[model samples]
Target: MKINILIPVRALHDGKRRLSPALSATERRALTGWFFTRTVAVARSVLPASDIILVSAAPDLLAYGQEAGLHIVAEAHPGDLNTALRLGAAAARRKGADATLCLSCDLPFLERNDLEAMIATARPGAVTIAPDRSGIGTNAMLTAPIGAIPFLYGQNSFTAHSAAAKAAGLIQTTLRRRGFACDIDLPADLDSIGFMKNDRHIIAAE
Candidate 1:
């Protein structure tokens, strides 16, 4: 399958609000930037660079993504997360992508093999949803034919997406891979990243 990976990035300067208790605004931006850089690198390992699309409202990030040789989609301002992902999927389909996987930007532990395995589960007219550690939010989702079902990405999105897929009569799979499960959103998420807590070197990577 000609799959494209769509990564929706919030503006670097206004991300990770949940981490405010533990991280200063500047530190949150820095951490998000670091996460994006590594996420893109890991994505490239599983798919060709051309198959990765970055969707964001930040002009700076869009410019950087273009410069880095990844497809860039300009998300409309005031839109929700699902809207950005829908725009990204549309953009990918326009570029001849047979399927698209929407990935969150906070997965610090994502690896190539895990992503590859997730993509392998996707077939034409299928939907694959990966839940976050809480099992309520959706960490990653794949829809073939690019837009098989309406994007249901928000609170309790894992259940919403599954219901949508079932309603659409599309094949659905729920994958609970470790790398995809551990998206860093809260203070507890930071504590869960064992290696990052012990190794300042990795956390401070620029």
Candidate 2:
């Protein structure tokens, strides 16, 4: 079975707005870049470069993705995240993928093993949903047959995705693993990253 990883990224300039209380605009973008790079790195460890798709409305981000050897797909709908994800799903399907693991770019602690375990749970008619540490948000989701379920990706998406999968009669698996539970978001979330709160090393690539 061909499995692909799709990550949809917003423009870095406006990303991580919730952390603005503690970090500057430059810091936020740097953090965004760090996470984006980290996500791609973990994905590359499990799959070939061609199978990891990066979708973004920002041309510079797309260009950076292409430079990293990821399959770049331009998000046609600028501000609509679900539509952008759908476009990534379509791109994965076009590349002959049997399943698409939709990944969020802000997973600071994600490792290669996390991605490998997620792939192992993927089936032809089933989906795997991984919720955030808060259990109120979705961190990672793997949908079979490329886009078997509609992308409901905002505001309590963990429940929304499960409902969508149940409504479609597809088998659902909920994975609550430590590696998949954390994602960088609010100012408080930075404290758990295992380093100094203002450590600028994450954005050293800049």
Candidate 3:
């Protein structure tokens, strides 16, 4: 099957606002850069043969996507994450994608094997959700047929997505892995990821 990896990123300034307590505005922006860079890097590493589409409201990310050789889909100026993701999925479907893997940008530790394994084990008519460290938030989602179900990402999103998948008559499977579960959200999350002290990509706010 032709798999398309869709990565959606908001503006650097607006991305990861929840991390403000642990990171300043400047730090947040830098973190956003690191996040996107690593995300694309991981995606490329894992799905090198698959089509990779990056959807973003930030024009700056367009160049980065281009440099990474990823297909860039500029999102509408003001739209939520789900909308941008939908746009990307539509584009992927139009491009003849048989499946779409929607991923979050904050996962820097994600590895190629995780993705390859997921795709290799995926079943049709099922939605694969990789939950975050807390096991409540979804970090990665695999939706077959692209428009099978609405992507709802927020607090307690795992349950919500599971319900949505069931409603769409798609089996919901939860897969957990360190690379897929650890995302930089709170200060504690960063610490857990071991990027709090010194990550080359990070720029302190003050």
Candidate 4:
């Protein structure tokens, strides 16, 4: 299917700021590194290393992706999340991608089977979203023929993405998945069982 996966991560120094009440800046930065590492591992488990792309302006993170044998799409600058995603998607399309999965870098519980399920059920010309636990934010999105709809990632982004897809005359579906829904952003997000096991969830057992 010439599938490509894009993961957009903010520079470590500027990430996880919302968790300031529970984590110091240094701690948050360290946790950002950990989250990125684990998210890359999960993505690798689902797709070939060459098909997984990390988009970021952070030199260290770009280096990490290169060292990990993943495709590195420079974000140019740490601009808005949606802009970074658009850049990544464009890069993927130029690389001959027929489908792209835009994934969140903080999905600590993401499992390969979750990706497999979404891929298996994805309909062409459709926008498939995996929403966060709160069902208000998007954790992952799959779109065929990349750039079918504008990327709207932010507060209440799940609704925005859905509306964009419908407006584009594309089928829109919300794919509920435990692993894909469990992104870590706040102190309360640490309560998932997968987090306790450090995300060693079943990858091949669907």
What does each candidate score in C-alpha RMSD?
A: 1.9, 1.8, 2.0, 4.9
Q: Which ten contiguous residues of candidate 2 have the minimum total lDDT? A: 197-206
Candidate 4 deviant stretches above 4 angstroms = 191-206
Q: On lDDT, who's better, 1 or 4?
A: 1
User: What's the C-alpha lDDT at position 7 in model 2?
Assistant: 90
Computed on alpha carbons, the lDDT of every model, listed in order, comes to 0.86, 0.87, 0.83, 0.83
Candidate 1 lDDT at 80 equals: 83
| Order of candidate numbers by TM-score, starting with the best | 2, 1, 3, 4
Cα lDDT of candidate 3 equals 0.83
Error of 2 at 117 (Å): 0.5
TM per candidate comes to 0.93, 0.94, 0.91, 0.89
Please give, for residues 34-81, the per-residue lDDT of candidate 2 as tens digits. 888888889999999999999998989899889989999986657677
* Lowest-sum lDDT 10-residue window in model 1: 197-206
How do the residues 142-201 of candidate 1 rate in per-residue lDDT, one tens digit apiece?
Answer: 898777898888788999999989998999999999989998888877887863533554
lDDT of 1: 0.86
For candidate 3, write residues 1-206 as lDDT tens digits: 77899999888898788888877788898888877887888889877623899998788888888877888899768588788888999989998988899988888778888888678756678789999988899999988877888889887999989999989999777889887898887778877767754566566445
After the best TM-score superposition of candidate 3, give how far the Cα of residue 42 lies from its true spot, in angstroms.
1.0
Q: Judge candidate 2 at residue 92 and give its lDDT.
A: 91
